[model samples]
Target: MTVTELAFFVGASGPVTAEGTEVINQAIEVQTEWSTRNAPSMPQGRENRGVSFLQQIEDPSVYLLTAHWASVEEHNLCIAAPENRETLSKIPPYFQVDKIVYFHLKDVAINSTSGKNGEISILQSPIISVGRLTIAAEKRQAFEQAWNEVKGILEEFVKPNVVKNGWRLEKENETTEEFVLVAGWPNLEKYRDFAQAKDFERYQSVLASFAQTRDLKCYRRIL
Candidate 1:
């Protein structure tokens, strides 16, 4: 199972200053080394598919770290290992550890169109949206069923703006009923114009029918 770790962080003192971001980057450097290293720590080591740093489009101060892993069990094992503890301990000075919240979602392939120089198309895309969709408690199965009804229709409705789109399942233990939806787009204008378009009316209604609340924001990858 492919799992993607999403950690939301803010600066300890206030909005992260330029210098604070630099300090955090330095710490990330250490974590990067530990993540990429070939070591004999665990029986079957964790897989670090790729690491990304994202900044909120509306507010640059809010930071997010996205990491891909093999499974949640493997992720827990790697993070708890003594080899990685030192790096974790250093994060508090630059970020508010108490306020940090995370969710590890089951990720689908976020790859690109094949080419001579292929890459993760999502990262290269101008902006991506990470949507936090909350449904009624214990309504995971119901929500998926509802979405399946409109998935194909809405996919076509959104058109080329939604270059790639999929919902990442939030584990049962993480939250009562939440799905992390990731959408790749070339620009924000095209994405925002969805509401004004007459075609989106019915689909939006279908979407709102199942979703209790949605907190979605555009983000650009900085690292």
Candidate 2:
């Protein structure tokens, strides 16, 4: 099944205090509860699959809030709901909104045990390296082919400690076709080790050949 992800980028206007953090966390919990409750009946027969709140370790004040839905239409339905809008309205006062991006990513390739019963928690590998890219229009097919190869290579390198290495594509067309790759590692030490390895170099080389624009960042799961 395909998943639609709504990503919210936000940061504190100033240094976030203990109280501010608590408020943000509570707000997220409430929002998730509401969404989960309304998921089954949402438009387009959508389901609220999951929700996560991530904080950027490099910049503690910055955060990434992601919610997974059955499809893009379902996500839009939730957004259009008055209750959902009300919950969302409560969030902005707590932080400075940066930008919001939506991705309708289908899991094209994954490990055998990716979505099996024994799934690793975000807390296990709190650090997630997120790579976002826009593929050159003419090279889309080639890029996807290269991605399949890259996924196989990553399976060999980022295993055990690296619980998840997921690749997803954006359904909507921007200036170019967009994709996101999220690699989860136990800690910065493990992540750095993988990055410095030869396999990572190969991965980067393969990506560079077809990627028109690439942006990479790291974030820690806070909720």
Candidate 3:
């Protein structure tokens, strides 16, 4: 039920940098105010969620906001609130949000070398991957076998640049039969090259043979 992450990507068309920052800062303030004021009524054990924004180094026009929520019901309640609605309405003039994508994060790795009191350093920031695949009832085994092969390549040949990587099967409660891959990378260029490589394409072909439907995307942390 946890909301591991909710990512909002700012699109190409939007206000200039200074204006966008102003809008984001305002949104943060409003969200914080609302959360605090409604804490008593908010779902128990879910009031300590956090949000942050990250900007892509290669593409300044694109930025991401990631929020961690306690549960799906809490997220729904927050979105449906009148104050939250008002806050969302005021954002378009300053920023264009592509889609509010949701994810359930799996913590693949954490480095505790910093040795500070509860001050863990993020050696590599989070990366989010979203995808959906066709699932055939009778061909599940075949599909799994193919996926395993591709995963092997990913682990051996593709994951060196990834500081950490892991995949999760989606919940039956969701609308789509989506599977998510979460990874952390030292650099985006390395992940970009790995995705477009010939070997990766070959891996995809192998997967496509068994998949009747497919959707895929890759995202880097901006906030």
Candidate 4:
């Protein structure tokens, strides 16, 4: 299955100024270029891949680097390569490394009311909400089942307001059980409207039953 890898980076000490943001964006662009040139030969079941960079709207000091790979093994192979590792190691000076997590796409629910595509992109949407949770190991199955049931409801509830909605499970992590849900909207007001809706509360309640902790934040595309 396809996997999405997310790396969160926090700015050093003080607030990240405009200059700092520019530097970080440049670094990400450079990294993308270098990775594409130095990528190791792909193993079986690994072909399509891409990467993106995002900055938090509420907190410019936080950035999220996203990678879409054909599969987790493919991503691992690239990470294991000496050239890739060396290139990646040079990125840390741009920001403080917070955490790296991987996720496998579970399902995607799209609202039928609008003709707009559900794919998340800055060109298509102005705001994005990233909801992260650590689910109990024993309840993983139940959590996924609940998501299957709730995703459609979520799609209907948000209707034309949401551009994209999808869920993903953590690929592998020893410290915690994590899952990520991302929703895209045309603007902050529309997103805030969804947050304040009763359906969102119900959705959260269902997730809370299986989750140990949750963190949700909004981000704007920077590059």
Model 2 segments more than 4 A misplaced: 18-27, 35-37, 41-48, 108-124, 161-175
**Candidate 4, 1-223: lDDT as tens digits:** 5456666778775446676666655554554554465554422211133355677888877777665555656556666766556656655555565543344553232212245665344223567678888876667778888887777756665444453434455535554567777766777887777667767877777887877888888887665
Let me know the TM-score candidate 4 reaches against the reference structure. 0.70
Candidate 1 C-alpha lDDT tens digits along 3-64? 67788987776667666666656556655555556433422212234467778887766788
lDDT of each: 0.64, 0.60, 0.52, 0.60
Clashes of 1: 0
Clashing residue pair totals per candidate (backbone < 3 A)? 0, 0, 4, 0
| Per-residue alpha-carbon lDDT of candidate 3 for residues 79-125, written as tens digits (9 for 90 to 100) | 78787777777667656555545444444232212243533223234
lDDT over C-alpha atoms for residue 77 of model 1: 66
TM-score of each: 0.77, 0.77, 0.57, 0.70
- lDDT sort, best first: 1, 2, 4, 3
Model 4 Cα shift for residue 7 (angstroms): 0.8
**What TM-score does prediction 3 earn?**
0.57
Q: Tell me the tens digit of each residue's lDDT in model 2 across 1-223.
A: 5463637555557445666566656655655565567664432211233456677777676666665555666667767767656656655666665554555566422122455455544435567777778776677788888888777666555555333333455445645777677666667887777767767888879988878788877787666
Worst 10 residues of 2 by lDDT: 41-50
Which pairs clash inside model 4? none
Stretches of model 4 off by over 4 angstroms after superposition = 15-50, 80-90, 98-123, 160-176
Flag regions of model 1 displaced more than 4 Å. 23-32, 35-48, 111-120, 157-175
